[model samples]
Target: MNAPVRRRRRRLPLNVLLGLGLATIVVAVAVLAPVIAPFDPMRMAAGPRLAAPSLAHLFGTDEFGRDLFSRVVRGAHLSLGIGLAAVVAGLAVGGLIGLVAAFAGRLVEAVLLRVIDLLYSFPDTLIALALVAFLGPGLVNATIAIAVSLVPFYARVAYSLAVAERAKPYVEAARLAGIGSGRLVRVHVMPNIGQSLIVMATLGFSSAILSAAGLSFLGLGVQPPSPEWGAILASGRNYITKAPWILIFPGLAICMTVLAFNLLGDSLRDLADPRRTAPQRAGA
Candidate 1:
């Protein structure tokens, strides 16, 4: 076990390493936006309006003459912040629901699962859109909408994990030994499922960011002057033919961010698979 663990540690896949590097860079940029941004993100006339990318302005200027680069950098804060907050909220509520359903009587499980099924049937974007429309527009509303939309997915994943763990012989032994359901679940089930939840959270984060951006693009998320990536995309849609840089740069940022998260999640899933890792373990 120790040899295999050390072997795995020493042989990180290239794509996983790249994913980590990209994610780290993005986080660093988001954290240091205020210091690293050349000009104020909200400042108008920071450069020539609709200017092309150049040394003076790396991502050029938007229609309002705001520095596109600074705006994109600044926008990272809202995108990442909302995504993280929403995923955490979704996981908490959804995980609890799943845990309760998994441990509860058959009637309760049936009812809870039906509701989860209903929510899971719809597309995430559609659910978020409806929620945002009902809740009214803004960053707070968008986060809530995105989080709510994500609940069913997390709930299903949690439920599956919990039920499987509950059926294991060790869990049966714990029950025979007079372990309370709550203690048993907390001590045994949760630890077993934690890694899966981490992978799900990583994947869900990309979805949350994408959903938040979609809301912003539809004028239902972070409002203007905030420099959110989706808002930037929306603002530049009209200038696609003339000032393409305004759209291109922000789009690239979103694409890269989402891709980095997906790569990380895939790598984690691969690492967690016993079938894949067992070979390496045996070889080691």
Candidate 2:
């Protein structure tokens, strides 16, 4: 037991390290967009329109003759922000609902679970699209739509973990020791299930980013003139044959951001549930 524990604690997993490194770099670039961007992302130059990548324009110019590299750097701000915000909202609202429903009586659980099931029945993209259609298009509306669509997933995961935790002997012991219901949940239940939530949130971040991009691509998200990855991709579709750089760079950014979050989520899941070790060879 001691040997296994020591081995597990020896160093951080390679996936975690790589994920963290990539995520950190991307986040750093996003945060430093104002300082690092070479030119105004929105400013168009007639002379430079559709110029290829050069020393003057690293990622080249878009159809509008705006700096592609600068637009991409600035675009990270909106794309990453929306993704993180949506996931945070989903985790908070869904986690609370799950915990309350699981801890409350059967009637409450039944009602809440039914509502969740109803929401879950719709495909996530469809839900987002419907919400966006009703709410009208914009960054905030898109973020909210994406967040709402994701709530059921977080709630389901949290509910399952909370229900299992509630059935444990430790919870029974806590209750018998005169612990209040709220206190029991906050102190005993949440900590045990928090790791799972973190893993879920990490994975959800990637989903949120992808969903937001898709919505924007369809003109149901961030509008034009805004430096969003999806909006940029949509704008560049017309210029694909003439100037491919505009599409390639922003598309790569979205891919990289999603990949970073996914890798991080996988690493966190592995670390959280180390019990999922490979089966040993029989009679080795």
Q: Please, what is the TM-score per model?
A: 0.92, 0.91
Write the residue-wise lDDT of candidate 2 on 40-118 in tens digits: 8888892388999998999999888888899899999889899889989988998999998998889999999999889
Q: For model 2, what is the error of residue 111's alpha carbon versus the real structure, in angstroms, after optimal superposition? A: 1.4
Number of the top candidate by TM-score?
A: 1
RMSD of each: 5.5, 5.5
- The segments of candidate 2 whose C-alpha lies over 4 angstroms from its true place after superposition are 1-12, 275-284
lDDT of 1 by residue, 25-104 (tens): 88899999999899999999998899999999999999988999999999998799999999999989988899989988
Q: Candidate 2: TM-score?
A: 0.91
Q: Among these predicted structures, which one has the highest lDDT?
A: 1
Q: CA lDDT of each candidate?
A: 0.87, 0.86
Q: Can you give the lDDT of residue 190 in candidate 1? A: 96
**Model 2: how far residue 19 lies from native, Å:** 1.0
* Model 1: how far residue 183 lies from native, Å: 1.4
